[model samples]
Target: MRKHKIAVVPGDGVGPEVIAAGLEVLQAVAAADGGFAVESESFDWGSDRYRRLGRMMPEDGVETLRGFDAIYFGAVGDPEIPDHITLWELRLAICQGLDQYANVRPTRLLPGMQGPLRPELGEQIDWVIVRENSEGEYAGVGGRVHAGLPLETGIDVAVFTREGVARICRFACELARSRPRKRLTVVTKSNAQRHGMVFWDAVCREVLADFPDLDVDFKLVDAMAARMVTHPGDIDTVVATNLHADVLSDLASALTGSLGNGATANINPNAGVPSMFEPIHGSAFDITGKGIANPVGAFWTGAMMLEHLGEDAAAERLMKAVERVTENGPRTPDMGGQAGSADVTKAVLAAL
Candidate 1:
């Protein structure tokens, strides 16, 4: 049997709760399949660890995680720690360290779920957001010179390179080609941001040449937002910068049904290193101990992890089970039901 080593980092708040539910589903699937095995190592790294060690993780955390086949990451935020510090310290550190450049978020309206959009829209709003993960606005390029003074000014430079832009656009195009529509929408603000944004448009155009059959178009970031809501069916694959895609994908998730159903994969398509899979809904602090935190996102993330690990049948089976449960009944409160995390997880396993 093929055994895959997985590093589990249940970050904070509802992270551990939802991750536990996901693992249960994963275990159930593996037991039923009998084709492969998953050996996971859980790491106590997050806000609590930061409070004790003055850092989110040990200095060698990245080195330790490098050996895993994939990283199954839960949400990473706490009330005590600053958001930027927590994000940069753990999540960003791992992504940059591993060179996982493409952040892929797939949004679709699951069965029996009512999205903010009209119920008639249904699954027509399906979209895959290809975010330029490694660089762009999130790059820690600038700093503050003067602190706590009227003259203090901070600069956060947006880094855009030809290689970065081209590779991401190519990835999006290939993804678009794989879909039925073969359509791609490139998001940029070139008219305003001359240097970085304009360069992004140029690189995307250069990359489009390689895929002659693709039906590609460009839109300003602001206009793209309206189009996503107004005409989601017109878009199949979307490519954008880090910050733009981050915000857009959240909007995409909300339109599908709930943020609790969104999952993301930080992939290094070349397979040179391990990729990271996570639920983008974040740690819902208000529902941390309420046992009402949704586990659909984490379950979907686990399916993505299995897919990345070359377990295609297992991944598809897990997702079909989730859809079956969602279509039937007994959903979490986020999906307008009275079920708790464990209840939904049990329903999914039973469906499996």
Candidate 2:
């Protein structure tokens, strides 16, 4: 049997709970398929680790993770630790270290699920958000100065380079070309942030030349938000900077149904190293142990991981099973059903 070594990091809060459900579903699918297998090594690396060792992970965490086929990451945040520390030390560290520059998030309304938007706007909210993951606003540049004084100031610099912009735009354009609509909406704030945003627009224009058949347009980030709500059907694939895509994808998730249903892939498109797949939703600390935290995101993320691992048939089967479960009943509280995480997972496994 074809075997894949997976590094599973079930981070803080409901992360472990949801990741457990995802793994169970993955194993079920693999057993049923019988053509391939997965061997996962679980790591206890998160807030509890931070509290005990004064770091989210060991100094050699990234290097150790480099040996895996792919990283199946759950959420990474804790009430006890500051958000910045948790994010930078673990999640960002992995993304940057691995050069997983393309953060792809696909959002669509599942069958029988209702978004906050009008019920009439059925499945038109389908869109793929291609986020420039490595650089941009989350580049970890700048710092604080003159602490705790009247002249105290903090600066978080957004680093954007021509190479970065061109590569991401090319990736987005190629994605758009692959889709049925062949439309790409480039989101930026050129009107306000002249330097970086203008440079971004230029790179997009340059990249669009290579994909002449792609129908492309620009939307200032503010106007793009309204367009997403007012005319989501018009959009098929969207590309944005790191910070903008992060915020917009959350809105896209809520528009589709719930943050619980969102799935993401931090990809190194060149495949030089393993990519990370995860749910876009943050660690819901309030419902950490409640067993109501949604596992659909985790399960969907697993399907994505399967696809990345070249198990397309298994990935499709897994996703179809998830859709079947969502279309039927016994959904988690996030989907307005009374069932808990395990119940929904059971339903998915049965559907599979």
TM-score of every candidate: 0.98, 0.99
The C-alpha lDDT values of all candidates are 0.92, 0.92
Instruction: Please give, for residues 80-142, the per-residue lDDT of candidate 1 as tens digits.
Output: 899998999999999999989999999999998988887756567889999999999998899
Colliding residue pairs in candidate 1: none
Q: Please, what are the lDDT tens digits per residue for candidate 2 over residues 1-352?
A: 9888899999988999999999999999999999999999999999899999898989998989888899999999988788999999999999998899999999999887999999777478879999999889999999999999999999999999999999999999998998999999999999999999999999889989999999989999999999988888888999999999999999999997789999999999765488999987789999989999999999999999999999999999999999999999788888989999989999999999
Error of 2 at 31 (Å): 1.2
